[model samples]
Target: MSDPSRHPPTQAALGILFLILATAFFAVLDTSVKYVGAFVPVLMAVWFRYMFHAVVVTAVMLPLRGRSLLRTAHPRFQVLRGSLLLAVSAISFVALQYMPVGEFTAIVMITPLVVTLLAALFLRERVSALRWVLVTGGFAGALLVVQPGGNVIGWASLLPLVMVFTYAWFQILTSKMARTEDPMTMHFYTGWVGALLSSLVLPVVWKTIPDAGTFAILCLIGLMGTVGHFLLILAFKRTQASTLTPYLYGQIGFAMFCGWLVFGHVPGQLELIGIAMIVLCGATASWLTARDRRLPVEPPEA
Candidate 1:
């Protein structure tokens, strides 16, 4: 039976579509990350991305939101949120150095299972048998995609895994914050904090600045990322999280396309099969989650 208490109804129509598009933009942003990573350290790429994102966030927020935008009553939470983002970005860029963008993105699709497991273990929430099955299948698909024993697997495969665990944690934090703050305020803190943390870190590992073309690409990376996040907000605002979650798997397809177009990289038949497994696992998980959320609860021992 669906747990009405556990799930909320879809927010709005536009928000759902925006979230879908947001995932697409995120895939594109990742492609840019890989393209630029070809010439520089992934950390350098991460640094430039956050720096440019900060500028865009600040510029856009200034006139519309004014100084009011800076007023986050919860500084500690804001910092924590940013710190999570920093870790994810840092790990991801580092991982990109060792793997293609598509492979990295493919691995990240396992996050749904991570979130489910974490919620059950840490939050003491009940997980359905069906959901657990989906998580297991998703991970099995991940291993197939990774094929640790195969030539395709490398130490870098671990980066996206790190990204997965951290991102899952980040989403948990966001879920908590969503109850207490406005979306814009949440976005403000998220961008500003990431920008600040990356700024401080970039100088320490500091290599030479990127050339103009590379720098420009980095800026485009920033823009796409910002749009991607904002699209998430839009999607959530219009539809329930459950409604938007399914579209996330679309990133794999986008990742595949981006991989081919940006780097002339093509997945082998096995990876293609892995992608199919991931798609099935992802779809089943989403449907199960949404289905579970929609089912009516039965009173125990009534």
Candidate 2:
């Protein structure tokens, strides 16, 4: 059989395609969360999201990888990682109730910038002047999206920012764990951990589906989250992350399109400018990270 990674050009192209498609699925996941959040309690929705994800991943991977799928060197870190992502999902569900899908997505895309900041502060990693500038510009862009006195102000606006920080830490931990852990094992543990943690509160938040349509949407949320991260893993396997990093910003565009299509929400001029800035700065930072060989090839939490 031909070696899949031998042809750089072909592998890169496939990686880009998979990354873009993964972003689309993430967009769908967010849009569905926003839609379903209105009818379902946020915690309940979160539980369903993680539960479905864990169940599906278990069903699919068990047969293929057997018990090896459950092995992990850092079991405690896996739980911590999963807990952080569960926090992210809960925060995202609440945030979406107040923020537009596109704008929320744009703000979350600042994660790479935040990661740079954290690495410098905690890891004592030296950062370049240009990267610092990009990081500053990226947050500035986020400020534009969640401008002061805007509709997304107050605690609601702060949610995604909180998510960025939480997710930044998650990314840092994942990068550390990826050095010694199987990606599939990490993926499996993350799902189950989130599911189990959220289930602790399920009894308080659980409610009837209200209708079949809502149940389907809940399932769609799980499928999108699972498939999106799975595709990200496939993309990284096929090609290097630096080559695929820039296209990750495509999630913002897909999200904006989904927002407009689903909610008829068009961003104002300033929001558009901010979104553009975030995309530019984030993509540039990722490129620089790749050039410096500092970018870790790991799938992000959905």
Candidate 3:
């Protein structure tokens, strides 16, 4: 197998392809999460997702790396990162129950902008004024999507916002820890930590899956999560993070298509406009951040 790490930094074309695949896989993963959410208890669905993630990772890694696969230099941060992602899954899954997948996906796309703004505030990074404008417009786009009184309201809409906030923090933690930890090691711990923590609530919330079909969907959810993330990692290895950032927006289009095909739903005029605004602003912010900071020569871990 060719080592992606040795690939030229300018593989923008291949990176876009890989990123598009990653987003498509993620869209499928979200669809499965939504499917399982319909029949499974939210907590139980999340637990199963992580539990199966841990299972898949362990099954693949233990033989190749032996017990070393379980070791981590930063166990605390690993656990925290895993816990944060579990929160994201739990909240986002609930949002999926009530919101259209495309709109929800578009709203969550604000994560990169939120990360940039948070970096400026917490990391004290000097964000150019243009990037700040982009970030502001991103939020404005999110507001248009939510449209407080238009239709989506109450707890349903807030869930994605919460997911966005937590996901931004998750990315910040990932960036910080990426400096010290192996990506595979971090991936391993993320699965196990989430599985272990979510297992605590399984006893109370666990319900027997009604049939083999639901069982398969639950398994598919876990499988897709792991695979989607794996593809994301591979894409990063092959090309610069900045080069792949724009392609990530492809998820919204995939989500929209999936929503229409599976659920027979389409966004309204305002919602479509909001999704466009969010995509444009978020992509601009991502490009500016990459242009300004010049991402590390080392490939970013997903």
Q: State each model's C-alpha RMSD to the native.
A: 6.6, 2.0, 3.1
lDDT by residue (68-90, candidate 2, tens digit) is 99888888999999999999899
60-168, model 3: which lDDT tens digit per residue?
Answer: 8789988787777888889899989888888888888888888889999888788888888988988888778888888888988888766766768788888888988
- Which scores better on lDDT, 2 or 3? 2
Deviation from native of the Cα of residue 68 in model 1, angstroms: 4.0
Question: Which ten-residue region of model 3 has the weakest summed lDDT?
Answer: 293-302
In the predicted model 1, the residue pairs found to clash are 1-295, 2-295, 2-296, 10-240, 11-238, 11-239, 12-238, 12-239, 15-234, 15-235
> Is 1 or 2 the stronger prediction by lDDT?
2
Regions of candidate 1 where Cα sits further than 4 Å from its true position: 1-16, 287-302
* lDDT score, candidate 3, position 127: 80
**After TM-score superposition, what is the CA distance of residue 137 in candidate 3 from its true location, in Å?**
0.6
Candidate 1 C-alpha lDDT tens digits along 28-51:
888887778777667767776677
The 10-residue segment with the lowest total lDDT in model 2: 293-302
Ranking by TM-score: 2, 3, 1
| C-alpha TM-scores of all predictions | 0.86, 0.95, 0.92
Q: Is candidate 1 or candidate 3 better by TM-score?
A: 3
Model 2 misplaced regions, further than 4 Å: 1-5, 297-302
